[model samples]
Target: MLKIDTVFYNKLLKNFKINIKYAKIKTIHKVIIGRKGKK
Candidate 1:
């Protein structure tokens, strides 16, 4: 049971990290598009 919990925790952390990366990229893309619109 302990081992299973640990594995689940690791997967959750990995998914969280990936989500953060994707969010950052999305924000950056929005910023770029905003700048182009301003021009």
Candidate 2:
């Protein structure tokens, strides 16, 4: 049904957003570590 599909779509979108956020954080953390290593 349309409602069920929307629910699923919303959940997928939310998960995708969370993943992007986590990825960004990971990259930032790596950059910080790299900088510390250089020092």
Candidate 3:
């Protein structure tokens, strides 16, 4: 089951990276919106 464990770990790591990237994008969008609203 060591192979399965590695596969699962890789998937989890990938998902974590995707989540962080999505969060960064969302924050960037929010910052832009906020700046626009300030005008």
lDDT of each: 1.00, 1.00, 1.00
Output the number of the TM-score-best candidate: 2
On the 0 to 100 scale, the lDDT of residue 25 in model 2 is 100
**Backbone clashes under 3 angstroms, per model:** 0, 0, 0
Candidate 1 residue-wise lDDT, 1-39, digit = tens: 999999999999999999999999999999999999999
**Model 2: CA > 4 A from native:** none
Q: How do the residues 1-39 of candidate 2 rate in per-residue lDDT, one tens digit apiece?
A: 999999999999999999999999999999999999999
- The sequence of per-residue lDDT tens digits that candidate 3 reaches over residues 1-39 is 999999999999999999999999999999999999999
Worst 10 residues of 2 by lDDT: 1-10
What stretches of model 3 exceed 4 Å from their correct place? none
Candidate 2 yields a Cα-based lDDT of 1.00
Decreasing TM-score order of the candidates: 2, 3, 1
Better-scoring candidate (TM-score), 1 or 3: 3
